[model samples]
Each structure stands twice: as C-alpha cells, then as structure tokens.
Target: MNKPKYGPPHHSASPRYTGLRTYMKLPNVNDPHELNDADIAIVGLPFDTAASYRSGARFGPAGIREISMLLRPANAFHKINPFDYCSVIDFGDLPLIPGHIHDSYDVMKEAYRQFAKHNVVPIGLGGDHSVTLGELRGLAEVYGPLSLVHFDAHGDTWDNYWGKKYTHGTPFRRAAEEQIIDPNSSIQIGLRGTVYSPDDMDAAKEMGFQILTAEEARELAPKQLSEAIRSRVGNKPVFLTFDIDFFDPAYAPGTGTPEPGGFTSVEGLSFVRHLPLVNYVGFDLVEVLPALDQSEITAQLGAAIVYEFITIMALKNRDGKT
Candidate 1:
C-alpha cells in the first residue's frame, strides 16, 4: 500500500471530498493565451459514434476529470508539485456534430486547431481513439511530420474497419498515409491479442512503424525497454497516445474494449516513464468507461497517466530551453 503524507485520507469523513463536486477547477480552454503564459489544456472529446461494441466511452472525459479532482496535490514518483512549474486548464468537452462522423471530426479538429494556435499543450480525455486523428491533424498542421509512441494492445493500423472508414482502428493508418506522421520514427508498444487482421500487422511494418510485443518487452530488462523506445522515437516530435485497454482487464475493467492477458497497469506506467524527453511533445489518455466500473480503479489509473505526463512536461520544460 502507498503511504500518505499529511492531508486527510481520500476516504476520510472530512468535508474536502464528501461534497457534490470532487475535482479542482482549472482554467477553461477558451481563456486567451498571454505572451509569456504557458498552460496545459485538458480537453474532453466525448464523441464515440463509431464504437463497434461498447458505447460508454462518450462518458470518459467527465469521469477522468472527476477523478483528477479527487487526486491529491503531490506527485507519487517525482515528488514535484504540479502547481510549482505550470498551470492546467480543464477546457471541458469538445462539441460533436450529432449523427455525422466526418462532421464530428471537424468539430474536434477546430477545437485542437484553436488550442494549437495559442501554443497550449493539449492533454485530451478522448471519446475514442479516433479523437487522435483530429488532434494529430492540428499538431501536424503546425509542426509538420512527427513520430508517435503509441501504447495499446492493438496495432490500430487497419486501412478500414467494418464497412466504413474512420473508426478508432484506422486513425493511425490514415495519419501515416497522409504523411502527417513518419511511421519510420513511430513506435507501437504493448501489442497483444487478436483484435484485427494479420494484414493489419503487416501494414504497421510496411508503413514503417516499429512494433514491440508485450512478450518481448517482458523479456528485456527495464533499461532495454527504455533504449528500444528511445531508438524508435529518435529525435522527432513525439505524440503519446495511451489507450486504457492497453492494460490487462483485471487492472482496467472499465474500458470499452478489454483485451485479456494484456499488460498490467504497473507495466503500462513503466513503459510511459521510460520514454525519453528528447522526442516527447504531447499526450492523450483515452477510453475509460466509468459505467462499467463502480470501484473507480480504472479512473484512478487514468489519473496516474496524467500525472506521468505532467512530470514529463516539467522535465521537458526545464531542459528544452537550456
């Protein structure tokens, strides 16, 4: 068990957490960017009109924000207070056009475009993996070709999923095909399970993404894992896309898609922490369906990922200029 510092426990009878609202209030995404102001915009995109199985991922952004409010001020591994170095704003959810897939993407794309213009780093709570497409579109529009450090159980490299295109399963493929992302510099980690076709796996390789299976990761020491991640990401702008289903179902039972025998929550964090700062750029935490969970373990784990990203930002900001 993790030992607490000084504040009242999370389950204490005190008034701090027993209220109707539990999360801390940060600035809204609509706030204008000042000349020297730097902020992390935490936006939620609840559009999940294309989910094939579970549909509650539309509720993920709110659930993650609620948990963030419940989190204490101290960082677990880094021991750094987030308020010391930067500011975070809860930009609320992106508006989605109802009943239209492409229209929904356009709405999210515009929101990202506005955030990018302000030089704000977006830490999004996703509706589905498809939100990555819109977010990447904005980033690529500004920064040109980038690399990816994708943590998930599926390759997400299918050309087309189901009868139509633009599902969560095809975003990376679309991005790579458009040359917005350099697959040669990208890394897809923790791939396991039979979620898609064999051809999809080949597409990831053919498109130039380096795929690291869970079994291979486990076989190597922690140092090797970090080295492999660094080698794949190289010296390009990196986008960190974390899918909750990347963890085993036992650790994350509240996701829309639960692949058994996947990496545990601890393993996922280890993978994230190993990614070096030279290539790091942005991140997203996606696909936590609170409707399926009452214990809130998945939500708490999602909060952990946000914390990891915060530490990365602190380190990056400290070193990037000097």
Candidate 2:
C-alpha cells in the first residue's frame, strides 16, 4: 500500500466529503522534523476532564475538524489566502491522559514545547479552558511571561472550584499565580453572567487582569476594543485564547457554559480581524461541545474562528507585521 499524501486534498481532485479530515484540509505532519519548516501548526487538545458543567468538549477537536472541511484557502474578509502565505499543517492531537488534569496539562505543554522549538505558531483546538494552562506553560517556555488576550463569557480566573485547584474555571488564576502570563499586560473580555460570589470579578481584578464585561464590550466599537487590547499588550509576546462561550448562546450553544449578552458571530469576527497587529505567539479556540450544538452551528462558528486566526497569521505574513 502507498503512503497517504499530507496537506489538504485538492477539491478538484477529491470531493470535500472524501479523504482524511485534517483541519481545513491541511497536510498532516506528525513528525517534529517534518514540521520544522512549517509556519503554522494546527493541533487538537481533546481533554475536558476539568469541565464544571458539560463533559462533551473532549470531542471538540474532531467536531471542529469535521466542519472545517468547508473552509476554502482564501479568506474574503482579510483578502489573503493563509495557505498561500504560510506553510500550515495539521500536527494531529496531543496524547492526553484521561481523567487526570495535571498529567494532561503536562502532555499538552510538552507538545507545545516541541512546536515552539521550531518557531511553529500553534493554533490549538481545545478540550476545555483548563487546557490553556498547559498551553501557557509551553508557550511561556519559548516566549517568557506572555501577554494574554482572553475572550470568554466567564473570567476563568476564580482561585479554585469546589476545593479543586485545577478546574476549567481556575486556569487563568493558576496561570497568573505561576507567572505563566504577565498579569499586568493581560486582558479578559466578554465576562458576564451570574457568579458564585460578587468577589469573583474582584479576584480577577486583584490578579492584575483588565476585565471587560460583556456589556462593556458590546458598548465599545470593535476598533475601540482592538485599541484597548493593543494598548494593554504593548509589544509583548501574546497568547490569544478564545472560548466558544464568548459568543452569545444563540450564536454558539455548544459550549460547556453558556452566557447571555455575549458578542454575535459578526461582532466576534470583527473583533478578531482588528487583532492582526498584536504580537501573537500562539492561539487556541476551546470549549466547543458538539453535543449541544444545534444544526452544527456552534462547530461551524468555531471552525470560522479558527479560520480567522489563520487569516491573522496570513495578514501578518503578508504585511511582515509579526
């Protein structure tokens, strides 16, 4: 038998429904040596053990990949083709330990470390928000103390959840405590909904993260929010994390935690489009629960967001910005 070809299958040669389903039909390169020359690597982190609500996010990576088959090479909004500007490939998924958050985090971090070694910017499809701690640990090893730009309906900055220190709701707090991210330069946008305590926001504020409530974000123009983000990050190596719950439940209902009054899909894309100038080191889109997705809307939106992240990289490459 012949070895399968890597990268996206040609639409003319093969239908979108056929072939191995890599992200956006990109090449699959699992060997670090093969990935050394790649500009962007797409990987799946399919572990959701720490989720406080739904547990189906463990299937998020495959969900996103399945819908991403519809993505074409060109991004009409950005007016650039990501594959044309960068060598993007799928690095497959990391080997995560089931039912063990700490061990899974370690595996995630080690995988990212390998990507960082070759200057490959990783665009991760996440398991849960807790997986971000591992991503930060890995990226920070390459670029010390990264500036974070987090988009989510909740802060995920609570000190702890139910006496456990490593739940999805507590990753950012752990990141802040461990200095995986530069708290002063970090920002969390789209935070809203009821909380366990009024001090929930206070705790995140105390950690030095600039919090922008979903209401405030809705009030600001996309340009204004973009300026706020660029101002806060200020030339630092940045890690951008987007939780699917950042979108209004109407737009993305497949997340573990859904909150009202969040950004619409158009608004979310507009916000992301304005972020090409940020010094992004890595990016991830997490907490996409396919079980709750209505008509695959959430998964499609998640795939579009990942596509936009690639467009950002393409824009940067085109302008020589990053």
Candidate 3:
C-alpha cells in the first residue's frame, strides 16, 4: 500500500514523550498547503467563559492532547490501523478571546469554515459546549443545516442564562434558533440532572429533539441505543458532540457539571462502537476540566472517546463509504 501523506511517527522513530505534544503526535501544521493534505484534522477550541457552574474547561483541549500521546494507531475492536487509510494532522487551536463568547464565536466560525472549504473533517477538543454553536455556524455555511447527535448529562437548551442568550448550557437552543442544526433530525442522549423547571426538559422536545434521559439510555442495550440514533439521524450530515460529564462522576469527575446517575466509560464506548453507518461530518468532545481532575482519568476517557471517532472515520474510508 502507498504511504499515508500524514500520520503520527512510528514509536520506533521517537519516544511519545519527546514530541511537541500535538494530538497523537501528528504533525502540527497551520499552512494552507499542509492543511490541504489532511482528511481528518484535530483542532482545539479553547474558550470556556460561557460556562455556568465551573470554569477551567478552557484548558480542556490541552489536557486531552497531553494524554493523547498514549494512544496507538491500531484499534483492537475495528481490527485496523486508522492511519493506514487516512491522512491525519493536528491543526492546532482555533483563535479565541478569553472572556468574549460572541467574538470567539466569530473567529471560530471563520476558522472552521476554512476546514470545511478544504473538505477536512474536524474532530475538535473543546473548551466548553458553547464552542459547538460556533462550529455549527461555520460548517453549516458549507453543508447547510446538519443533523445533531448530542451526548451529555444536560439538554443545554435553556433560552438564557443570567439574561445572556449564549452560554455553555444554552448552545443547542441557540443552534436550533439559528437553523444551523435541524432538531427534527437530532437526538440528545444521556440527559440526566436537576433543572430549573420541567419547562427545561420540554423546551428541547418542543424544538423536535428526541430526548433520552440517562435512565432511559440505561434501559436499552448498546446496540439498541446506537440503532435508535441511526434511525433518527438517517442519512443526514450528522455532527456529533459528546460532553465528558455524560459519564458518571465516578468515571469522569473533571467536568464543569457533575451528575450522579450516568453511564460508565465502558458503556459509553460500546455506544460509540455500535453506531451504525451515517454521513458523519464532524465531532467534538467537551467539558474536561483538568484542574478538577487529580488523576487525569477524565482526560483519559476524553482521549479514548476521540480515538473511537478516529476509528470510525478510518473504517468508513476502508469500506469505501466515505
């Protein structure tokens, strides 16, 4: 087979700890020419000022990358090495302002728009859930309205927080309003936690999102759960967003919001693994706060989940589905 244009160096060439700490040690590039060669690009979205409960998710991108070096090319379950079929790169982080959500959103939208122009599928390491709203704006410019598959402990559909229309807990509602994501074809899984009112839950459903509370998710087998996602999403261009807090606090404690009744990491992986074929346009994993993570377990789980996404991309290429 011909060599892939871009990939992480083999372990024999250099130690994992010796690199500049780009995700999986892939070449970190910013030039348009270099960016053009990649099929999948790992980019960071490091702005978390919109978070309501806790801060420091701004460091989530760095925290996930710092531990991602431990990831290997081969996925044991997929029985294939992703790098063999796709060119991957670390494109570094999109530009952001520290405390400005709307300004950061503009910059992120333009940056991600460039990725879409180049036909690159961005797997983002996020600063907060609000980052997805910007990403959707950018990608929707290229791909119209997208179907959403959201996994989180919260619905994130609140209309406002503290008189503000945009916050970490309110991106999905904003996205639906902007018509960047079509809620009719969307599904939000693993929503479990206390809310301000019953209207909070009703809001997401009224907007046409198929809601699966954490308890409801636990009732279905992994395959059944995945099938439900596929059935709802169908063949639409789907963008997936995963909040690290979707897992139980015992499994992922370093998050802005912690909920007690959530699934285990193992179960989360099973759901991703069994996800059926669909037109996946992009993915993001958010809300990993390393300052709150004493053991880096949350970061570890975050990296693992992103790796599964990479595997899915590779499997698509291998099967000629891309």
Candidate 4:
C-alpha cells in the first residue's frame, strides 16, 4: 500500500497556502461539529461605523477571511504541528444589529464572551478598533484584568467621540477605566499619526500605559525591540492587537489611515514572533480596508498576519494556562 502524499488531491488542481482550505464555520460553536471540537475561534465583526477618517473598515473582516485561503508550512516554525496543537475554525460574523452601534457592541461582546467561557482563545477579524472593546470586555469577564500588547499607528485611547463614549478611538480609555485591562502591565507599540489633541498622549500616560512611538521601534534592532516589549509586559496574560497601519504605508497601502514610516513587514513579524513574559490569550488584526487596495494585497497581507497570530497561539506550551 502506498502512503497518501502531501499536495493537491493528486488530480484536483487547487493550490493551498497552509495546504488546507477551510472557511468560517458558524456561530456559537465550541468547534465546528465537523471536527467534534475547536480550540480557537476565528470570528468576523465586519462593522466600522466608528471610523473617523476612512469608512471602509466595515469590509475588513470578511475581506480578511476571503484571502485566508492560503495557510501553509504549518509545522515549519514549530516542533509540533499547529493543527495538532489547537483546533481553529471560523465562526461566521456576528449578526450585527444594523444602524444600532450600541446593539452591535452588545452583539460583539456576547459573541466573544461565549467562546471565552469555553476556555477557547480568539483571533478576531475586526470591524474597527471599537470591536476590540467588546472583545476585551468578554475576555476580561473571564480572564480577569488583562495585560495588553497593542501594535498600531494610533493609541486608540481617546476619551469620547462627539459626546459619544464608545467609538474605536476610546476602547482603551473605557477598558482601562473599567479595570478590564491592567494599565500598568499593558504597552502600546508602533504609535504614530496625529489623530488626537495634545492632551491625548498625556491622557494615555496618566492612565498608566507604556507607550512606544513608531520612531522608537525604528531606532531599535528587532531583537532589542522584542526584548523591550517582553520586559515591559512582564509575566502576565497578554492580549495583542495589531492594527495594519502599524506597517509602513509602502507595504500596507490599504488601511483607513496610512503613515509614512513605520515598522517594516519583517520588523512587524519579528516583533510579534518573540513576544514573551505573558500568558498569550486573545488577538485582533485590524484596519485592512480592501476597497482602497489594488489586487487584494492588503487583505491578503491581513490574512497572513492573522495566520501568524494563530501560529503563535498554537505555539504556546500545553502546560501553560491563559
């Protein structure tokens, strides 16, 4: 008897990135019934009304999933294969309550809260940074106050939006105030752009967040930067949020806001690959606007970046606890 070789199905000619082709499974599942169980939940939020500058982040979540059709070399970076580590499945986007931002927020909170209850970690596809607030609320509900490692071009720590309190720019402000995340343990990296007033940075500092501007990241070698982040976050459970605009605009041209010089793709990937000093819990990859992009490259990059995140979660040692 011959062994089944790894490639296309011998005759069927579909190519694969991870050598697998799986799509978002459904909502409210421990794992897809097809697998009998899942270890990580991949969900789409697909709403970005909270966006201030650009309006297409509503398309980000689905666009990311559509391009994730490439997942490969799954075992290359690890001693154990990822599929053998954590079972991952797409839980379709939350049924967003249209025209109701508050209701939509509640839906996102409820959606992720269910998975957190199952001891499943989440790799969220975003509607905007606002969706992160709901996701954090869910995680905080279960994990206790979290330590965050934020990678983005803006801090997203503003106080309020046009007298409204729950926009994308204010998730961290709300999260910090609620004690849902530990301000002392959390660190924000790759910050750039001029979104807020002068007081915003002061506010972020006052809240106890450790902020590293994008310029600082460029000054350090990758290893040094990674070490600095781990040291600052220390040994606590940490959640990572990567806003795609954290990349230099030359590489990521399709985000709602583009910054001129930021972390190179290699720098960004290396920065994430070495995160330590924390229990790895949840993650979100946000702000990839497909409509502004050509050739779907931005969305494709988002998919690859999310896959990198999934691999990191899978790399966590089994004996470890979030």
> lDDT by residue for model 4 over 1-322, one digit each (tens)?
1221111132234444333333322223433233235567777778778887786887888677666655453545445445545666666677775457778878777766677777667788877788888888878888788888898998998888799887877889999988889989888988887755777777898999998898877787766877877787777767888898898887788888788878777787777666552576788888888888767777777887787776676666343533
Q: Which scores better on lDDT, 3 or 4?
A: 3
Model 3 clash pairs? none
lDDT of 1 by residue, 116-226 (tens): 677667787877788888888877777788788888887778878666778887889989988889999888877888755667677689889998876766686656777
Ranking, TM-score, top scorer first: 3, 2, 1, 4
lDDT per residue as tens, model 3, 91-110 = 88888998898899998788
Measured with C-alpha atoms, the lDDT of residue 254 in candidate 1 is: 89
lDDT comparing candidate 2 with the true structure? 0.88
**TM-score for all models, in order of appearance:** 0.88, 0.96, 0.97, 0.86
Candidate 2: where is the Cα deviation over 4 Å?
1-7
Which candidate number would show the highest lDDT if scored against the true structure?
A: 3
Candidate 3 regions with alpha-carbon error over 4 angstroms: none
lDDT of 2 at 93: 93
- What global local distance difference test value does model 3 have? 0.90
**Segments of candidate 4 deviating more than 4 angstroms:** 1-14, 17-36, 73-80, 318-322
